[model samples]
Target: MHNWNDPGGKGSACQADKDRKDATRIAGQLNIPIHIRDFSQNYWDDVFRHFLDEYAAGRTPNPDVLCNREIKFKTFLQAAIDLGAGCIATGHYARIRKHQGHYQLLRGCDPDKDQSYFLHTLGQQQLAQACFPIGDLRKPQVRELARQAGFATYDKKDSTGVCFIGERDFRKFLAHYLPAQPGFILDTQGHPLGEHPGALYFTLGQRQGLGLGGVQGAHQAPWYVVGKNVTHNTLTVAQGDAGHWLDALRLLTSQPSWVAEKPPGKSFLCTAKTRYRQPDQSCQVQVLDDHCEVIFEQAQRAPTPGQAVVFYAEELCLGGATIEATDAAFGGLEAST
Candidate 1:
């Protein structure tokens, strides 16, 4: 067994140490020789650079996905191989299988805890030597098994949200790396509603932290981020529900990384999720020379760019790509001013 604690400077040191200790105890109980690797600076710099680059490009990035691909699967996997290990297993709620002489990635039995979305970047080579020990068990069952085994983490609360941020203010944490450029918040008609800290700080369908109170002329409804003009440093918001802006039937994604090594054909049908924990939606995927285009059976909500759009066929995870653009428009957005 091996425990990889990324000892990046900042607040992660404590968590890394705690996790290492836990892994150590578990290894001792299981009577297995444990290995530890400290991937501090390289892992931190690579992931942080991607985060800043995405925000600068006016898009929200998924660092967790990159972390799993670059660090957990790539770096750590290689390290395990160097240690003469034939296969590497993890606690991730994902399953890998071999079918017809090819490796395949599958969703965990626990639907709510399935992590196939983040593991979409994995290829056939990696899946061939990977294992998920607890993929068939639900969270509660896993916890119960741990308790029966006398493990201290049996009741540990599950972690969520951005890993590095912990419980800190997201805006403030981001400002440290990407300095905010305050700009005017405009309505659909290009009327100024208020001032926002930064256009990059907000995303489509965002409702909270807009800081806009009741405007005398505008409707009393709460504001929602409808659009953003990143080039002009302007954030477009709309009063009342902003559901109209999020409706999109089609989206274009960057070069997709298919789990099977390449796409099945020129065009194929599949279900996809543009964000983590999102319910799978039906879609038709058209593979293009430069990118992939997705036409959903029903209009999707908030298909934000810079996030990953993972494709799936039933329980099998096909692959994913970074969303580059969406054909969604803000036509129905009403602005009193």
Candidate 2:
């Protein structure tokens, strides 16, 4: 077995150390030879390129998704094949199965822990050479098995930190990498409400860390980021229980990467998740020349651009794409196409 320690440390040295120790322990227990392939420099550069590019494009990027596709399944997978391994397996909460000679990506049995959202970028070839041994078991069942085997991580808390920055102050960490262009925080009416560090630091529906409260005319309540006007360097926010600014019924996605190497059909009905662990919502899709437009049965809240929209039919994953834009409902009509 090998641990592909690709060179990259956005700022998580401790996490890397912990991961190494865990890898070592697992290798020793399984009596397998462990190899550490260092490619750290390349790893960080690749992910940073994706992160910065997306944020600069006025979109919220999921670095974990890029890391999985570029590093785990691409760089590391290739490294393993070069070392004469026929297949590679990960602890990700996802499953793979073959039906009628075509491999399909499935959600792990544990709905709460399924990671198929972040893995939708994986293609058919990658799925064919990959395995997920724990996908069939629930989190508790896996924990019980680990406890029986006396694994130190039998009850280890799942890492909820960002992939690159861990749990550090996101704005502070990002400032070191990207210049913060201070901008105006405006309401939907284009009235300036406040000032922000930068639009790149915020995402759609982000409520916390906004540092907004009781305004002169606004209500005494929390505010949410509803939009980022990249051209004008403005951040749009809205207040109230129903953040109407954050609601959307239609979204266009960048060219999707399907698990079957092609879409099922030009248009079809399926359940989709706009974010991880989000309950599936029914949607109708229409394929575009360069992207696909999805119309949710009910208006969705905060369909952030640059985040993934994973499609699923029950448990089978149909793959996903980066959200390009969303159509907000305003005055009972489309706000943005």
Candidate 3:
């Protein structure tokens, strides 16, 4: 098991060292020689220089996705090859299948826990050397398998917060690096209702904790966050009408990975998922240069930017991309374009 704990900030080296000590101690007890690589200083100084700089300027960065593609798969694979290791393994829940003469990446069987979407940025070469031991199993089956193998982490609570950086309150974490700016909560029609602590603390589909007191409609029903006008520092709220959420979305993704022998011409039908936990929805996928457009047969609510959009056909994962934007105009099946 490899633990890459680089938080991309000052004093991360010390933290990484402490984590390594703990990991080494545990590995010794289990008679496993675990290799712990400390890349904190290098990550902050090198791999994430631009992202860290952007965060310093108050921009949110998806460091987890970047780490998987650029560092763990790219740099670490090279290091492993140099060390005479033929394959690299990870805890990612994606699958690899041999097609024709090449390996292709696919979503795991557990739809609720599939993580292939975040891995779409990886190229064909990385997929060839990657191994996901738990790809074919469900969450419960994985736990049972771990228990049968006498692994203590069988019952371990799922880790939260940013990957490797450990747990932290979302606002507190961002506040450590970015300045907090208060924002307003507004209705779909632009009526001010309440205030939010910061724009960065909220997401496109969030529902609770807006601190909006005078929210009038849906007196008994809960409200959900439908959208956010980042430039104006305003959040749009709506009654928990599942119908008003989302139906279709257009994404602008960079560095796409295709598992197909040849790109599908014009459009093709596939099972698409906007979020990890969501069941695969029927949709038509159109691959474009630098991006792919997904038109869902059913409206999806609050398709947030920076999240992944994965596609599947039966058991094969065609590919996926980051959701750059969404449109509510296609709110229902009949409204699809």
Candidate 4:
């Protein structure tokens, strides 16, 4: 199984050493030799660079999705093939099946830990070459099995946010790659309430780390980030539920890809999620050659651009696309005073 050593953005330089120790210990127990591969260069080119570009564009991106498609499936898969391997496997909580001469990507039986959303970019080629040994098992079941088998990573805490950030302040880590652009924090009426280190550092519906306490004309209610303008270098905040202002009913995405290479039909209805762990939302889809448009039955909050929208039908993963634009009003996000 492949475990990425470098995840991106300020990942510890000694990450490889840590991985090697665990991998060596486990391989020794299993009486198998482990070959450690360094794909950090490939990771930077295919995953980290794209992540930085998306953030620079003032849009949040999911690096795990990029890493799965680029590093795990593309680069690592090729390396395994070169080493005379028939197929490669990972510990991802996803499943693959062969039916009617086509590989089907399915969600893991462990619903709470399902990772199909991150694997949506994978196509038939990757699916055919990929394996998920624990997809049919729940988290606890897998952990118990690993305990019985004496595996070191069985109890490893799941990484959150960006893997490379690794408990480090996200703002501080990102500030290193993208030079800080200090700007004013304003309200809906263009009133400057406070100052922000950078407009690109925040996301819609975010409340913490804003440092907006005791601003003039601000209400006693807690403030939330409602909008941002990267070009103009400003952030917009609103008290109370700023989330409603960021709700999006429809979104447009770039370069859609399907597991079967073509969608069920040119237009179809299916379930989708704007982010992981979000309940599957019923939506209507319209696929174009260049992009696809999805209209949700209910408004979704903060469907950030540069993140992916993954499609599903029952347990089968159809595919996904990169969110590009949303229909949210967002307090007239780019409006300048």
**Model 2 over residues 78-122: C-alpha lDDT tens digits?**
999999999899999999999999999999999889999989989
lDDT by residue for model 4 (1-337), tens = 3333433533653554566788899999999878778787787788888888888888999999989888889888998999999989899999999999999999999999999999988998998888999999999998899998979788977655665666667887888789876899988888888889999999888888888888776677888887888998898888887766688888888979899998888899999999999999999999988799888998898888888999999999999998988878763323112
Candidate-wise lDDT, in order: 0.83, 0.82, 0.66, 0.85
lDDT of 3 by residue, 128-236 (tens): 8889998888999988977886666678676544654454465665666666678888777888888887666666556678765455654756677766655677667
Give the per-residue lDDT of model 1 (tens digit) for 61-110.
99888888888888888989999999899989999888998999999999
So what's the TM-score on candidate 4? 0.93
Poorest stretch of ten by lDDT in candidate 2 = 1-10
From the highest lDDT down, the ranking of the candidates is 4, 1, 2, 3
Q: Looking at model 4, report the run of 10 residues with the lowest lDDT sum.
A: 1-10
Candidate 1 weakest lDDT stretch, 10 residues: 1-10
Better of 1 and 3 by lDDT: 1
Estimate the lDDT of model 3.
0.66
Which segments of candidate 4 are over 4 A away from where they belong?
A: 1-11, 14-16, 331-337
TM-score of each: 0.93, 0.93, 0.80, 0.93
